[model samples]
Target: MVSKILIFMLWFLVWLLLSWPPRISSFITGALVSAFVSFMTMDILVKDRPSGRSPLRYLWFVYYIIIFLWECLKANIDVAWRVLHPKLPIRPATIKIRTDLKSDIGLTFLANSITLTPGTTTIDVDKQNGYIYIHVLFLKEGCPDHDMRLPVVSKFERILKKVFE
Candidate 1:
C-alpha cells in the first residue's frame, strides 16, 4: 500500500512540474491523468519485500541521490571540455568491474549512473558472473587496481547500496 502511494506521489509531482501553475484546467487534467496512470501501473506492479529497516532509510537515499547529481554535473563539464579540445585527451578501454549489490534495482541504478556520467558507458552486465563491462574514456595504466587497490564497485554503487539496499 505504501509503495503504491509513493508511486502515485512521484508521478503527481512530476506531472505538476511539467505543467506549471496559472493554468487551472491543465493542472486538473494532468492530476486526473496521472492518478489514473498511477492506479493502473500500481495494480500491475508488485512491490518488493521491505528491507526490514527503519523508514528513515529513505532520507539517506535522498541524500545519496543529491550528492550523485553534483558528481554527474561535474563529470559532464569535464567530458565536454575534453571533447572540444583539439588534443582529445582520452584513452578508451574496457574494464571488468565487480559490485557487491545483489538486487536488480541496485544493479540497474549503478548501470544507469555509469551511462549518465560523461565519457563512460556500461556495455553489459553479467548477472551470473557478477561483473559489468564498462568502457572508460580516460583509462590510465592499470586503473585504480594498483594504486588504491580498492574494489571496482564504482562511485555510484556506493550510493546505491545506501539508497535501494
Candidate 2:
C-alpha cells in the first residue's frame, strides 16, 4: 500500500544519495536494493493495525531531522575545537538519564540520536524502566549523579516524542 511505497521511496532516495553520480546501472541497482529492503522491513515499519497517528508526525520527523543536523553541526564544531586546542577539554563520563518516551521506537530514536551526535554515544538503554546510559566526551564539570546542563538529549528527545511516542 501507501506506506510500503513511501518506505520504498525513502530507501531508494537514501541509496541514491549514497551511490552518488547516479548512473543508469546504479539507479537500477539502487531501485532493486531499495525494493528488497523495503519488502523485508515494511512489516515492522508499517504495521497492519491502524497506528492512529496524524500526518503531522511526518512533518515533525522532518523537523526532527533539521534539528538533528543542527545539533550535529554544533557538536562537530565543539569536538573539533576541543581536539585542536592544547588542553583537549574532555571529561568522559557515562551517566544514566530517565526518558519519558514509552514506545520502543521513540526510545530507540532518542538513543540513536544521542549516539549520532558528536562526543556522545549511547552505551546502554534500560527500556523496561525507560533509562538511557550515555557516554559523553564532555560531562560539563558536574555529572555522574549531579545535575548538569547536558549538551545533548533534551532537544532531540522532545521532537522524537512528537514523532514516535
Point to the candidate with the largest lDDT. Answer: 2
| True-structure lDDT of candidate 2 | 0.82
Number of backbone collisions per candidate, in order?
0, 0
* Leading candidate by TM-score: 1
Candidate 2 at 70: error in angstroms? 1.1
lDDT of 1 by residue, 11-124 (tens): 888888887773888778877988898988986664666567667768877886786688689779989999899999998888777767778888888888787776678899
Off by over 4 Å in 1: 22-31, 144-153
Question: What's the C-alpha lDDT at position 164 in model 2?
Answer: 77
Candidate 2 C-alpha error for residue 107, in Å: 2.4
True lDDT of residue 137, candidate 2? 89
Q: What TM-score should be assigned to candidate 1?
A: 0.79
For model 2, the run of ten residues with the poorest summed lDDT: 142-151
Query: What TM-score would every model get versus the actual structure?
Result: 0.79, 0.74
